[model samples]
Target: MTTEQLKLRSMIVTALFAAIICVLAQLIIPLPLVPITGQTLAIGLAATILGARYGTISVLLYLVIGASGVPVFAEFSGGISKLIGPTGGFLVGFIPGTFIMGYYMEKTSFTFKNAMIANTIGMFIILAFGTTWLKISADLSWTAAFAGGFTPFIIVGLIKAALASWIGVLVRSRLVTAKLLLPIKPIVKEESI
Candidate 1:
């Protein structure tokens, strides 16, 4: 494909992933502080499939939609307040977490083992930012924040991360085989005569 065609394709793919993230956000199981949501799962998948820069852009787009007062967050919640609320950090954390995750997936061949490790680390990054934000925003102690933000969802997070990694890589492989998605090309240095 030409440069313009590639750019357009990237845009469309990123938008699709952003929409998926929005839909996944609705799959929430309400908790006291941070509700369980499939948002992370979608984030992981986008990262694996889209690579670091594009994955981060997809997440940013999702945030933009939510901040525009769209009901794209958990329990059909949205607006700027949600971005500043106790769970906001987790939402914000998705950017860096996904970047890191995508970096791993992009740098290495997409394998189930690699995906699992990348997603697991990404989960930790999100939890760190999220737990701290929950503590500060909710005025809770560290232990309370851990209980509310981290403890209640550990097992679920692990399962979701693993599944997102495993399934995302498989989907990406299929897309590659079908020539629907292009592999990331490393920049080549030109020699000056």
Candidate 2:
């Protein structure tokens, strides 16, 4: 493909992943504040497949859409309030988490082990930001925030992370083989004395 074609393809894929995250966000189990949803899995999938730059773009697109008063968030919630609301931290965290996951996936050989580690780390980033935001937004203590935002979601988060790692990596491999997605170039880092 020509450079322009490649860029177009990348843009299309990034937009598609953003739409996927929006659709998946609707699958919500409503809770007091932070709800359980398929968004994390979708986010992970996008990051793993699209790599850091494109993956982060996809997530940013989703956030922009939601912030623009589109009802693309959990339970069809949107607007600025949703962002400043109790669970908004999780939404903000998505950017960093996606970038981290995608960056790691690209830097490594895209192995399952690496995916798992990256996804786990990304999950924790979400939790950290989400829980902190929950505490402040909800005016809860740290322990209460952990209980409400972090603790309740731990098991489900792990499951989503695992699924995202394995399935996203598998799908990426297939797409690369089919010449549909660009292959990630492994990044080499040199340690300085």
Candidate 3:
């Protein structure tokens, strides 16, 4: 494909992933503090499939749309309030989490093992940001924040990570085969002739 074609394709795919995040965010199991949502799973899938740059772009787009009162967040809630709300840290954390996850896959390989490691690390990053923000925003003790935001999600988060890894690897392979997504090329240093 030409450079323009590639850029166009990337833009389309990035926007599509942002929509996917919005749709998945609505799938929530409400909790007292922070609800369990499919947002992280979508983030993992975006990173595994789109790599670092496009994946992060998709996440940023999602945030922007939600913050603009698009009702794309969990429980169909949105706006700046949602972004600064108690769970907002988790929302904001998606940016770095997606970037790091995709970056790891780009640096190593897009295999299931790598995706698992990346997703697991990404999960912790979100939880850490969310827990800290929860403590501060809610004016709760660290122990309370841990109980509500951190501990409750560990097992479920691992399950979602594994799911994202397995599914992401499969889907990424198919997209590459179909040419919907291009495989990442490794960088090589040029030697003087």
RMSD of each: 3.1, 2.0, 2.2
Rank candidates, lDDT, best first. 3, 2, 1
Compute each candidate's TM-score over C-alphas: 0.92, 0.94, 0.94
Candidate 3, 33-97: lDDT as tens digits = 99999999999999988999999999999999999999999999889998788999899889999
Segments in model 2 whose C-alpha atoms lie over 4 Å from true places: 189-193
Over 99-131, each residue of candidate 1 has an lDDT whose tens digit, in order, gives: 999998777768888889899999999999999
* Per-residue C-alpha lDDT of model 2 across residues 33-152, encoded as one tens digit per residue: 678999999998998888899999999999999999999999987898988999899999999999999998888878778888888999999999999999999999999999999988
Sequence-dependent TM-score of model 2: 0.94
RMSD of 3: 2.2
lDDT score of residue 132 within candidate 1: 90
Q: What global local distance difference test value does model 2 have?
A: 0.90
Clash pairs of candidate 1?
none
Instruction: At residue 63, give the lDDT of candidate 2.
Output: 96
User: Model 3: what TM-score?
Assistant: 0.94
